[model samples]
Target: MDKLRQKDYFLFASAMYSQPISCSSLVEQATSPFVSFHQRLGCFHSDWHQHEWGQLIYAEKGCIHVNSRTKQILIPSGYGVWIPPDTDHEIRSTSSQTNIRSICFPVADNNGSLRQTISVFPMSTLLREMIRYTNRWNQGPVDEAQATTFLQTVQGLLPEEIDKAVIVYLPSTTHAKLLPITTYIQTHLARPINVQWLASEFGLSVRTLSRLFRQQLGTSFSGYCKIARIMRALELIELGCDNVSQVATDVGYESLATFSNNFLAICGHRPLQFIHSKRLY
Candidate 1:
């Protein structure tokens, strides 16, 4: 947290965004209670801040990670975070070319049903298209009638609760020794991962290393490695690295069939299907 930067206000659009519809236009849009920021971000993050408006911070390309003190939400491409008004959180981009679509709505637009905590929602074919359509809608100020219709459509499409978003419960501890090990697994996904091999390389007995993973992370070393590989693959895919065979090799699977099987098991979509279905460009 100490290493991160925070902005006083995240609701306003940054210069990085180049939407045909200017941010100012939306701010003054008639009865519309929402305004949005669409931009491609470099390697930067905002300080913890909250506003009277609830928000949805998303990445059209790459991944966006949102964290509160107790929880961390990974907004992998195709996923979005529904942050309630005034919820304290910090945001950072995992990639240099992270394209963000952040929307803010006054609390009144929540309809008294918005969840108090951060939650993930789906962008179905209809929902996804609506988002794009709305972002492009700049025909003068929106009236109360139009705003109500727009808001109703959005709320109807949103899920009642968080579904399958990748959320990890973070330990308050820095987990110094364990952190580097995970980083290695992510970076070296193309290589085989063996707990004994890692333990030996890191100068820890296999048993001690095993215990550390189980006790601190509540997951076995191999389990953690498996997830690390998949998460990395997801990132690469969202970043436009779409060749399944290439992705399989990059993520350490020698067999393409094996890779697809694991991908289906974890992501519920075959590698190629997932790649095509994503909103990535």
Candidate 2:
């Protein structure tokens, strides 16, 4: 449970793995299952790389975009992404001054929420405090006696109870027919979303597209489109784009009242309140 020096993590992958195709061997014998670090994200980037240790990444500020072979996920504040050991992944920040805190754990699944692949966890108040506390402890001096107790208590714990922590899940799917339509919908959210119109444009019958949505995503076309618009609207607000009315119009809502209602329903916060609340957090 000893804290690592700056150079330790620089050679983290190399020290833990000689083969990029790492296994659980290194993690099995780790003295400490956790290592925490704070990093500021800018345009700085890394090539797709991996470690033998599983990682849980928390964005304390702004947004983190992660890309791997099967999943490209966004980790917003108050959310954590659990990346399994030996998985190929890359990370980027949408904002220049974004702050990220990551905890790397040994590769083990001991009846917990950690998955063999990437999983998103919602951060609870306690989990958030634990993260900050651990980081502060690591950065300050260490007491040999307390370090062992701290490590034992915190290392394998999940951020929150799985059900309680769950939030927006934007699944990136590979279904052939659904892929193009979903992409088109997300891209063209500024325009009205009409399933029949899409069916005409994509050369599929409206019934066929509706069936595809049911089979693949388990949601109606209108349901999915509304969520997409709300997501985009949130992004616009986060980017400081405009007032609520302007954002509503920008995302193709005919009226601010309609936009506010949908935004509240989907996000659990009014548009302006959400923006102000995010700044407070």
Candidate 3:
């Protein structure tokens, strides 16, 4: 097996905003338990980076792709990606114009295990609104008890476990020759894509590509594609795509029956049923 490169295994981001003069920072600057909100423009690019304080990253208006050492998470609006402090991760906007709102908090104590991986959570509407309100309080000396109470309420709502569907972990190898192929498959899910073409484009043998997929993703290329398609379908359904047949076609499945079968197999329910339940919730 080929050895992984350090650069390939990690992402780097250079831009970060440290909070100023807030009680969260004032009281806890040494620990740096503070919250700040940001609006990122279309051209902004945050390379891979880590911080002393764990971060709660949420998107108020857009979506982002987050990659930790172990997995990659697609954080859309209403979802937040939690990074324990000192975990190496990268972030990029899915849309050209992306708007993000985030809260950075210091962990009560430095626990190395907590910083080991990315934990994604559903950002409930109430929690989102509360963060917005709390950010309004100036960073000067504030009532410690009230501030602590607000922080506790924020922490209390975080779910113990997050249900995530699509996550890609980077290998130690620096070879990203296969990444373009994966990116192509993700971006063109609605269209027909074949291994022969992918291999040809990358100047690699089909067998080599297959082996790479199995090694890097722990699944066959076809399986990865199906999972990716299902994830996209779920996102669309959540956004009010009620017609399952159309969604199936949109995600590159030729037959509606086949799409339904695959969707049921992966999601354990029919697409319509899933969407209906989501609506009820």
Computed on alpha carbons, the lDDT of every model, listed in order, comes to 0.64, 0.64, 0.61
Winning candidate number (TM-score): 2
Candidate 1 lDDT score relative to the true structure: 0.64
| Clashes by residue pair, model 2 | none
| Model 3 misplacement above 4 A | 1-32, 38-44, 69-72, 94-99, 110-113, 138-145, 156-177, 200-205, 231-244, 256-281
TM-score of each: 0.69, 0.71, 0.65
Candidate 2, residues 30-93, lDDT tens digits: the string is 4554566676654334457777776777877765666777555666566677777788887765
Please provide, for model 3 over 118-227, each residue's C-alpha lDDT reduced to its tens digit, 9 standing for 90 to 100. Answer: 76555666766776666555455556577667766665555443344224222222349778888888778888889988898889999999999888767788877887
The digit string of per-residue lDDT tens for model 1 on 103-158 reads: 67665554666656777543455555556666654445557567657766676555
> How badly does each model clash, as a count of residue pairs?
6, 0, 12
Candidate 3, overall lDDT?
Answer: 0.61
Clashes of 3: 12
> Model 3 — TM-score against the truth?
0.65
